[model samples]
Structures are given as C-alpha cells and as structure tokens.
Target: MSGDDAQQHIYKTHGLLLNPIMCGVCGWQFYTLGIYNAHQWMQYGERPHAFRCHAQYL
Candidate 1:
C-alpha cells in the first residue's frame, strides 16, 4: 500500500475515525477510543495531576 493508504489502515485498525475526541480535563485530542481509555487509565489514582476526563467530539 501507499504511505497515505497505510496510515489510514493503521488508523482504522486502531479505531480512529474522522472525528476528533477531546479530553475535558486536559484539552488533549485523541483520535481513538483506545488511546482515550489509555490516557484515563494512566491518570487514575491519587497522583497530584489525577483527573477524570469526559471525551467530547469535535
């Protein structure tokens, strides 16, 4: 596959759609639900910067 096609395939494989999801707590953008979930998992517990983020599509 070509470079662009390969990139699109990777994105699709990872559940990244056309819409962009933003983190409410940190204003970070995630292209896939898996990535968003990973971010939440990393922020869990009693860390100084711990926060719950609601994903908003933009």
Candidate 2:
C-alpha cells in the first residue's frame, strides 16, 4: 500500500475507552467485550444499558 493509503486508514480507525463498573458504584476497566457483555447482562438483564447519559451513538 502507498503511504497515503496507510495514513487514511489510520485516520479512519475509531477508538473508545471503556470504564466498567458494577452498579455504577466503581469505575474499573473490563478487558474484553465478552466480560463487559456478561457483567451487563447479569447485573442489569439481557439488554442492559448505561443510564447516566442520554446520548446514543449513531
């Protein structure tokens, strides 16, 4: 690939920092999506969601 192609790919990548918590009491990082999914489902139910913010990612 060309240098320009590499640069564009880097710029297009999306990143997110996840801070996991139990019952919104503690802020800890959940290493993987599987862990996060398990925690959310067990704690809040099948479709658990964050209640703190109203913004939804499109």
Candidate closest to the true structure, highest TM-score: 1
Backbone collisions counted per model: 0, 0
Tell me the deviation in Å of residue 31 in model 1: 0.4
Residue 54 of model 1: what lDDT? 45
Candidate 2, 1-58: lDDT as tens digits: 8654444344345322233223453344564444555666666566544333533221
lDDT tens digits by residue: candidate 1, 1-58: 8655554576668656455667777888888656766775666532232123444332
lDDT score of residue 24 within candidate 2: 51
Each candidate: what lDDT? 0.59, 0.45
Which 10 consecutive residues of model 2 have the lowest summed lDDT? Answer: 14-23
Give me the runs in candidate 2 sitting further than 4 Å from their true place. Answer: 1-26, 47-58
Task: TM-score each candidate.
Answer: 0.45, 0.34
Report the error of model 2 at residue 2, Å.
21
RMSD of 1: 11.0
The worst-scoring run of ten residues by lDDT in candidate 1 lies at 45-54
